[model samples]
Target: MSSQSSKQMALVAFMQAGSTSVYAGSWRHPAADLRFLEAGYYADLGRLLELGCFDLMFFDDRLAMPGIYGDSVAEAVRTGARPIKLDLSSVLGVLAGATSRIGLGATYSTTYYAPFHVARTFGTLDHLSRGRAAWNVVTSVNDSEAQNFGADIHLGPEERYDRADDFLQAVTGLWDSWEDDAFILDREGGVFADPSKVHELRYSGTHFNVRGPLTVPRTPQGRPVVMQAGSSGRGRDFAARWAELIFTGDPGLEVARAHYADQKKRIAELGRDPQSVKMCPMAYVVVGESEAQAQEREGVFLNDLVDPMASLTLLSELMNYDFSAHGLDDVVTDELIASTTGIRGLVQNLRSHIGGTVRIRDLAGHRATLLQGPRFVGTPKQVADQMEEWFTSDACDGFTLAATHFPGAFDDVVRMVVPELQRRGLFRKEYTGNTLRDHLGLTRPEPSKPSERGDDV
Candidate 1:
């Protein structure tokens, strides 16, 4: 990493293709636009975040709708809890057309999709965006998502990561198949490309078997920047080996610092530079002209906008455990915790936050407002102060700002908080480079040689 005084923060906007943000109640905010189904909505968002000089804007996705709660999707749809999940590839195309600088990213599960398909899709996206594409790698969390892919059960954590490890190898191999200078485009000589310059992937792994080169040409950035948000040990290991941008959801400064150190150490142990992998924790910032005004803005969302049942439904979906079987006041039993196949890190964090026996209601309440990460509510300068402290304290490389509402929440940050950060010399006043790697201070990856390739291929 650069010295603390000179290291500028890498800002990312956390986005969703559905009705609300990660905060389930955000759609209920009067200021939030309800036209999320339209491509124009995301296009506007893309342009706005680009204006703010955000390094990247990525969409979080789930393969299936929330239905684990009482084994029904009725309550989720009725409460407007992410019932409209649009395919991100189309949305990302709109965003690529709308913005010129900011990076575009979307989630795709390694478990559900074929590696060749992912390599082609993101490679094409990188070309479309002129090297501004990123891919957030995820192993689908729940049986609901598994069933959506026609599987009877979700893989356990170990198995999921194991498959993901191979999945990444195959994808990267296919991406590396075409040398940067392979395309000749020489119609005069009738030689469109050079054969020796292009090679076959022949990637054969435990989870994937890719026969040859990807359909897409070499991308501008060599490959799309790899983003991962895995808090579990196996997940972290996978991230350490592959991820260039690591997203985290830490509740406070101390916890975030520890995670940062651990991840960096893991990366270093894997023979990679720790600074090459940027660590960004999610933060929900409610900025206003005054601290009181910001607090009021936050209060409305936490106290009024959120619906209890909607939160419970989300909690069930995320944890992969049906909370409906237990009463609101029921203790979060050890058995219940052990049975959770979803985000186990979230359950542990909740236990730490409670500092005692956790109840179903407590988890519901936590999920209702902002699932994880710290909430910063104050004047623009005050929020910047908090952000600066975290950045300089080895807590994170920067932040992935979560919006309480769409467009408007981003508008507030771009109009208010960004200026403060720029004034403080903590963030970029303008984008210094074109590609996503350039914005994030990452180097373009070189095409892999056959000798350097994994044995699975």
Candidate 2:
């Protein structure tokens, strides 16, 4: 048995289907790919992450273009601020065909989609990917997304989580509709499946009522791995009950440590093994041949490449409040914090990071990186050292890496940083298993009978 201290770190590549990753102006970088809509682009990305031995590559998404900045889409379109969006499911399918080991994850909102559709979609993905699929469950945050879904306004956090609870129940029930041995495929017997093994999920809840057996059969892993990235009180509780993997963006190491410990405690309180739930926070790394070189590159990104207006646009969308109305020198106030309907945890994190007070312009640009997570800029050894410190201190199981520029940013890590991590024995040199659960050191869940099935968490 491996000792607790000897556990390997899990790494995931935080990706998107748009022209840029998380950074708004990254697309302007000469090395960044402009043709993100092409299937070959994602295929190359998938293969690269697999080459680096990443546990998974997740595609983050939004349902609508960000128009909350000044309540207009002009700035969003002009700055190329996540304006080009693609269907994540179709992107995942492309990624699935390109890579074999690295897990393919796609973000799907629980708010807009029916439980049956979500279930069938991910279940089909899991089958197509040969047990290497993951679902990044998200509660749609922006009012623009709600508007596209025909809602006059976005639901509050509590109500969203409440509906999400029902959503999870119905989806997992549908996944469990078919047992592992249900398909006999007997040609002589003239039967493709055993009727006795197939079960119906007659689920009725406040938000959804899904009934009957799912169209898809049982997947290779029984069910796709469930990942959640909410950080509020309700979000954490929901994650504790349901998520096998948790994503977060705490700005400081101390805060991340606290969040990690609290989540593990909550998991234990929920009668689940704390070791089973992994906490991976987002990180941006800029690596170079030397520390000074890395610093210079980082300066180019933050100073030259980043468009302050575009950055603020994303921040406004994330906070669900208009920041364009405020003067550049205006202080981020308590009233502003209280008025946001976006994400309470994110607002609180921003407040904590700012401490006393922050100017509108400064907060807008800097918080773009801070709000996403920590940023580490240095040589490969220095970056690896910070990662080791966080991993060893229990701040996180690993990191979900975000790119400052397309292939260049990722290439730097894969070439410079990954070797150092491998030298320290902190990361995998090669994948030992084909399934995503295996890559994460999680045991495959056995199929449960209909009567024996309880909560999916």
Candidate 3:
């Protein structure tokens, strides 16, 4: 476990395989690259992040396009509001060959995919990357995603978590099918592997039932480091149980500190070491040579690029509701709150930010800007100072850096901010180990039954 004095922050890059990032205005930035459709774009990104000595970079993905607003994809596509989403598996494959040290990850939803497929895919990735693999698990939202999978409706949050519990059980069981020493490669004896060491996972659960050992052998870091990015109460509990890294979007320093403390307490109550699970909030930074210049750049260049329709479209997509169905001034209601099947944490954040009641216009504005996360606008030293304050205050373990533009946003952070962080000794100066687990200070788990694994913390 990392003591407070010795605890260095673990940084990750929050990413998407699209033209823009979480910010709707990213693609329009004069410095933003528009070649997301090609493999080279992501390769360049991977290399840049690795050069900065970032711990991991995971692509956040959604199964369906943003078609909830006005029940059409036209506005989303026309404004370039996250309309394009390439297959993450293929993109990660490209990165696997491009970079060596930085951890490569991609989001895969448990709601749509089968456990065996997810287990096999990530297990193979872990091997191919030579232990530099991570998987961001998500219980998908959006009925449009359900529709694409031939389902008429999306499941409620309770049902989704319950199903996810079982899904994780089956997948981890499959990952643990082979022991560490299962593959012997005995040539003279004419045997490739020891059959006695390889065991079959005859898993029978509410959501899945798989019988047999996986095709792949035990992965180098046991399994790719498990990552989760949910912040609702149930979501927090789920993360405490499974995730080694948890990504969040707290709006300010106080909120972040509260969240960090709460999550740590929850982990401790579950008999897990609080330090074992790193809680990293999303940070949207605008770096420049001077603080005044950075603020000017954000005010003049970045903030103005958000189209109104893009804001409404993204809001509708995330809430799984139609903004066009109501007027901009319409007050948010209990019914409206209950109806959302999307990110419950985001809706809650919206409510808290509004205080009494939220309006459609308020939601639109927040969605247009960075959603419920602190945006650092300053020079390298100023940005680093803010980050150091948050780190020392127990507000976060680190940050999931969100981009305002593609290469430019990343380039600025790597070249300007990272060195300051390193000088303070709040972040790593160099990678000490190759695997994602090593990067995060987690132990390589031994093969064990699903019921017995998390018990040891």
- Name the best candidate (by lDDT): 1
**Candidate 1's TM-score:** 0.97
State every prediction's TM-score relative to the real structure: 0.97, 0.96, 0.96
Q: Write the per-residue lDDT of candidate 2 for residues 21-51, one digit (tens) a residue.
A: 8888888887888779799998998888888
Go through the candidates in order and give each one's C-alpha lDDT.
0.89, 0.86, 0.86
> Using TM-score as the measure, which candidate wins?
1
Q: Tens digit of lDDT per residue, candidate 3, span 351-435?
A: 7756887888787877777756888889998898888888889899899999988989899999999988887777888899999
Error of 2 at 171 (Å): 0.8
Off by over 4 Å in 2: 1-5, 369-371, 452-457
Task: Please report, as a residue range, the 10-residue window in candidate 3 with the lowest summed lDDT.
Answer: 448-457
Two-way TM-score contest, 1 vs 3, winner: 1
Weakest 10 consecutive residues, lDDT, candidate 1?
448-457
Assess candidate 3 and give its lDDT. 0.86
Ranking by lDDT: 1, 3, 2
